[model samples]
Target: MLESEYQNRRKPPRHLVPAAPSQAEFSYTLREATTEDLPSVLALYRHYVRNSVVTFDEKPPTLRAFRAQFEHTHKLGYPFVVAQSPSGDILGYARVQLFRDKAAFRHTVESTIYLGPASTGRGLGRALLTELIDRCEAAGIREMIAVIADSGAEASLALHEKLGFTETGRMGKVGYKFGRWIGIVMMQKSLRRK
Candidate 1:
């Protein structure tokens, strides 16, 4: 069908619609997150929570809960960093937290990274994750884990792999979100140099 004919027949689905070319140059600085940044960070997370299965969270997080996480990460001496745009907006965030509460798991951390929808495809995700890994290594962290949604999170899986993570295991049908079954792929990267 001709382009005009196709337009008249049916409107393109929102997800299928082409996005306007980004006009601004992509630029951001990576730095440790502050208490003041908790709100913006949560907003970025809410974007995924509401629209995608990338996160298993079915509801947006409350500020108090997010604050507690921020505090806990810091209290454990883990890194919580953000990518700030030139306009002072938070483009994305990356952080590491204790993988488990047991003392035996002290050297193991779980890495989590999230970028706003508009920040996707830019190099921010890579930069943010790299910084997180570097910080973890600097702090004597021995291992980093990435638990990614197996479905609808291919980009995250690919990013982790590009950063030298390897799949360790997978648990199928472990989560339910958006009324659909989803699973997790566990990826691990050694932060300690041999």
Candidate 2:
């Protein structure tokens, strides 16, 4: 082949994935969630509850329960973030909640994140999770905990690991559903630099 032909045939540099919400590729914005976001949030949660082992519940939480979650988190001053498309579509959500009711556990919080099946694998999970960590740190939270179902270990575990969380405990046969018992992985991140 001629040198010019070879040069011209070389693949053009691939374009970057644009962020969501914009007409751009895969980009999105993370913002505080509101009650209006509950439907989409429940839809995503129910999708996994009904279709995957990501959660141990045999039945999805009711809309009433989800509303209570919003109220409870707000009362506790936890950060609830929604990953949104520029067009106002919610792609995913992440939040931090009090780890326990005991006084000694007040400085610690457990975090949870959920992404729509359509929104997974686009880096939205990581983005939302990192924001959860940031919000916890800013709130003087001393530790961030994650309770992961054994079957949901991949992305959730990897995301926590990337954010410096360490696996601290594992409880076998702690969750029962679908006529089966499942294990649990508990991970924690120290919010303080120390």
The sequence of per-residue lDDT tens digits that candidate 2 reaches over residues 90-113 is: 889999877888889988888889
Give the poorly placed runs of model 2, Cα more than 4 Å off. Answer: 1-24
Q: Flag clash pairs in model 1.
A: none
**Model 1 lDDT, residue 165, Cα:** 100
Residue 85 displacement (Å), model 2 = 1.1
- Which segments of model 1 are wrong by more than 4 Å? 1-22
State each model's CA lDDT, in order. 0.92, 0.85
Which candidate number would show the highest lDDT if scored against the true structure?
1
Q: Which tens-of-lDDT digit does each residue in 6-90 have in candidate 1?
A: 8877987789999998787888899999999999999999999999998898999899999998898899899999999888999
Q: After superposition, how far is residue 33 of candidate 1 from its true place, in Å?
A: 0.2
RMSD of every prediction = 5.8, 6.1
- Give the clashing residue pairs of candidate 2, or none: 18-25, 18-26, 18-27, 19-26, 19-27, 20-26, 20-27, 20-28, 21-86
TM-score of 1: 0.87
